[model samples]
Target: MRILVVGAGEVGSSIASSLSDAHEVVVVDVDPERVESLTYSEDVLAVTGDGTDLDVLREAEVEKADVVIASTDDDETNLATCATVDTVSEAFTIARVEDTNYLDTWREHHGAFGVDFMVCTDLLAAEAIVRVVGLPTARDVDPFAGGSIQMAEFEVPEDSPLAGETVAEADRFDELTFVAVIPEGADHASVPRGDTVIEGNARVVVVGRPVSVREFARALDPESAASEVEDVVIVGGSTTGKLTAEKLVERGVSVRIVEFDEDRARELAELLPSVTVYSHDATDPEFLSREHIKDADVVIATVGSDERSLLAALLAKREGAERTIAVVEQARYVDLFETVGVDVAVNPRRVTAEEITRFTRERRAENVAIIEPGGAEVVEVEVDEDSVLAGRTIQDVMADLPAGVVVGAITRDGQYVTPRGSTVVEAGDHVVAFVQADALEEVTSKL
Candidate 1:
């Protein structure tokens, strides 16, 4: 497949880097330095030109592209690029925008601005934060199989019942699969074997039905298993924070938003009548104490600056907040946020990249999640009659699959199956599998 990406910024570069591994990728940008840097670092063709111009699109051979991704920082530029590409070819056009207004308009009117798909960073980040709020102990949570199946990552606490148990011994949930485990202080994660002992503080990834996952989470930490989120405090009035507050309010959860900027705070207060908006700096300990941050069931920091968000989250934790979630823009700071006590870290750039990469995957895959950033992925694919995966038992399939890959779960005719060796995959079944980054291509080909 041939893909043309417009923009060489963080999101664009990330999409190109990931797509280049499995497909022919061409990246366009006005900045020669960024284009040159990508050219030197990735296996993609870097074109230094204005992506919105027809001549530039022709130069990149957009007519031959299977997909054209417009990801410029400017929403107008991205829309224009997609429009131009649509005029010249029948390629699928994906446009990235930070403004919810543009996204809402595009979504209501399909093909508006010549965009087949629209990815909103703010909405994606907000949704990620909301998922964390729903499952407080999960470092990350993603839904697949049309919400019937879920993939979640949790840190094994020192006192967890399964802390010292091996994978085979800790298999208590009939509907859940323990896919992989990342040992404490380890740089890499692996598929857990029967004898693999889960150590304290290790990250455990599991996939199963939503109800089963909730039960498994409760078993992992009985004290923090209340899945109902009552109080949520957002420490920023940015678009991400506002969106999150809106979602929580719709779900009937009590929400309070704290903003440093008086004007923005006033706007949010007027827009969100159900939410409590405070015009105060979250970085100040006095303001936080006055707001009773310690009573918040979940505290989310989505400030513009990563440092500010991190600091606010730390303060929330210090104030005895049950869970803390921070929006960190820099990918490198994600681990640091967790290390410093943040329960979850949401990166908009990475979220956008993951969405775009899912669109680039084969049609059989209904959903794709970048579980461990660039290291691991979990894909939900439909077993087609023509595919090699159909009409085979899980044991038979595993024998031919590459290492570091596991069939996590399957859904057939609306019924969830925690795959076992004897479980046979039928055509039209949705199969979710965990694949290591290096084995993704091989596994996808077989599926």
Candidate 2:
């Protein structure tokens, strides 16, 4: 597929980078210098031009493109670009509109503007990061189809009911389905362990609809209260942190932020009137103690420095906070926090970059993620009527696929089915697979 990405800024560049592996990506920006410094390499075609201009869109061959994404910084310009694309081509157009005002009424406005989808960076980024502050016990959450289904990762606590239960026995919820198990001290990373007994605090992964999943998690340990966290404290004043705090407030949840920078702290105070802001060093144990971090339901550290963030979370956790989460950029320290009892270590750049990725690679990347440990991955693809595996079975598809990659299960209309040897895949079904990173392109052709 050919895609035109407007604005070679951080988000636009990230979006372009994610699609360059599989699609023909064209990047257009107003500033030639910005476009030049931005690297997409020869994998992507870069051009210097105003994204809102008709001539520029025409020159990029917008009509022939499969998707046109307007992700310029200016919201009005993005809307205009989307309108232009809609007028000229039948391609799917996604506008990167950041203003909350437009996003509030997007579902209704999108159809009138011929916008196939609207990328609300703030909304997505907040939903992705907010829970880290509210519920740090969860390692990761994959929300599907506007949150109709949620796949959440939780580690079994030492005193939980799941402590001594086997994988099959531990997952007893009728609604909650056990997806996969990444066992402790396993050399192979993750395994489809069925009869393996779960140790206390074992990383148990599950998938289910929203309310059912929460109930299932609550049943695992009633005292932990891991599933119900209403109070949250954020320790950062960055754009990512502030946006996360704001979204939580909109959901009628109480949130407090401790920012060290006076100027940024004041900005957050004025912008988010509902949230209480404290202008003190979040890393300082003295200030944290004064605020009584022990009573707070959750403590999230996003102080820009991985060391500082991790230290704050550790201090807060020691202070008796229920859960502690940190935003760390360093790859080495990702699992370090969880290992040392600090709940979550999120890579903000990776999270923010993937937001733009969804804009460019919509058809593909039905469930795309940049996995950890050697940058390997598992991607879920949909088998539409036009797909190669439309009328084929799992066995037939496996014969054509390389040995490194393999399909796992079938999701027909949001319902997951364990694929047996004779399981056949019909049209309009989504295929979840565990794939080797380098062979991603090969998986696309077969799907």
Q: Highest lDDT, which number?
A: 1
Candidate 1: tens digits of C-alpha lDDT, residues 1-447: 999999999899988977788889999999999999999999999899999999989999999999999998899999999988988999999999999999989978988999999999999999988877887688889999889999999999999988999999988888999998999888767999999999999999999988888898898898888557899999999999999999898888999999999999999999999999999989899888888999999999999899999999999999889889999988889989988889888999888988888888865777888766346888999999976778989888888888989899999999887799998899999999999888988888879
- TM-scores, each model vs. reference: 0.97, 0.68
Q: Against the unseen true structure, what C-alpha lDDT does each candidate score?
A: 0.90, 0.71
Candidate 2 clashes between residue pairs 3 or more apart in a chain or in different chains: 156-201
Itemize residue pairs with steric clashes in candidate 1: none
The parts of candidate 1 lying over 4 Å away from their true place are none
Q: Roughly what TM-score does model 2 have, to 2 decimal places?
A: 0.68
Candidate 2's displacement at residue 365, Å, is 6.2
| lDDT tens per residue, model 2, 1-447 | 888888887567767766778889888899888777664353788778987788998888888889888877688898888888888888888877767667667776656466787766555556667754433456777665445555666777788777788877765655555645555654332434568777775666566665666775676666765545677888887666787887788777789999988998898999999999999987677887898888888787878788888888888988888877777766467778778877777765456556555445445557654444323344566678877777877777778877545454566777766565477888877765655556667776667
Cα lDDT of candidate 2 equals: 0.71
Most TM-score-accurate candidate: 1
